[model samples]
Target: MTATIDTMISRLAAWLSRHSIDVLRVSLGLVFVAFGTLKFFPGVSPAEALSVATLEKLSLGLLSGYAAQAVIAAMEVFIGLTLVTGKLLKTGLVVMTGALAGFFAPYALFFTDLFPGAPTLEAQYIFKDIVLAAAAMVIAARALGARLVPVREPLERVHELRERAAA
Candidate 1:
């Protein structure tokens, strides 16, 4: 029974090691596309008002209202496309880094509004970006030739796998 359980766990881990990063990347892309699509239509996205305001402030009033929203929407869609298609992924990661900075800016700029006493819904919404950022980091590392090796795997075996993957 113990051996069976161990075998199951190892199989599950191996499967996750193979597919988790791709799944995360694709799902993240889909999320960006969905959210960006929402901004295209007014009164559809809950984050619409805050997103516009944040962009306006970030852009020093250069972008506002629908224009600001449009810029954000376009950026997100572009990121989504690159990630989903695995085309221009490095560029997408670069853009993602910048977008993440913008996404987190509100926490520093509007601390009081986001957290007057208890956390507001807006604060909660922004907090979820932390997970997205971490996932992006993982994807970026993988893109840069990093691989996940099981702990029990031998170092020589891992090197062989890396060599095979590179070739």
Candidate 2:
């Protein structure tokens, strides 16, 4: 059982190294672009309410309605474009991280509404951004030639990577 699990893990890692970055890049790019595009048409995106409300609250009610939604949509599109083309990757990752951070805000700020005993599907949806963030972080770190790892010695290696990048 242990050997089988190890074999599977090794194969998965090999597959990821061989092609997963491109796949993740394209898939995430498409997701961002498609979802953002949908925001242009009213009544399409389900998260419109949650998103706008979160933004309004974060912005102290300064941002609300379609105008605020449009900005968010534009940011998603920009992140998608950069990721899809593999250009301005650092910028794209930064924007993506920021966007996901916003998506994560509901769990923190609206704990009661999002989690009255059990979290709503909406909260689950927002929580999935953590996985996306992890994927993006992997790709971003790769783009920077920085190897953060679950497999390798992170403490020693990450320090080495930072020192190398800094030099």
Number of the top TM-score candidate: 1
RMSD in angstroms between candidate 2 and the native structure over all alpha carbons = 9.8
Instruction: Please report the TM-score between candidate 2 and the true structure.
Output: 0.75
Residue 4, model 2: lDDT of 63
Report clash pairs, candidate 2: none
Model 2 over residues 1-167: C-alpha lDDT tens digits?
64466567666776767677777887888888988887777678888888888888888988899877887899898888888888998899989888988988988788898888888888887888887888888788778886433363334565577679999
lDDT by residue (tens digit), candidate 1, 47-101: 8888899999999999999999998989998888888989999999999999999
Task: Give the range where candidate 2 is weakest over 10 consecutive residues by summed lDDT.
Answer: 147-156
Note the Cα lDDT for every prediction shown.
0.89, 0.81
In terms of lDDT, the best-performing candidate is 1
Model 1 deviation from native, Cα RMSD in Å? 7.7
For candidate 2, the per-residue lDDT at 85 reads 87
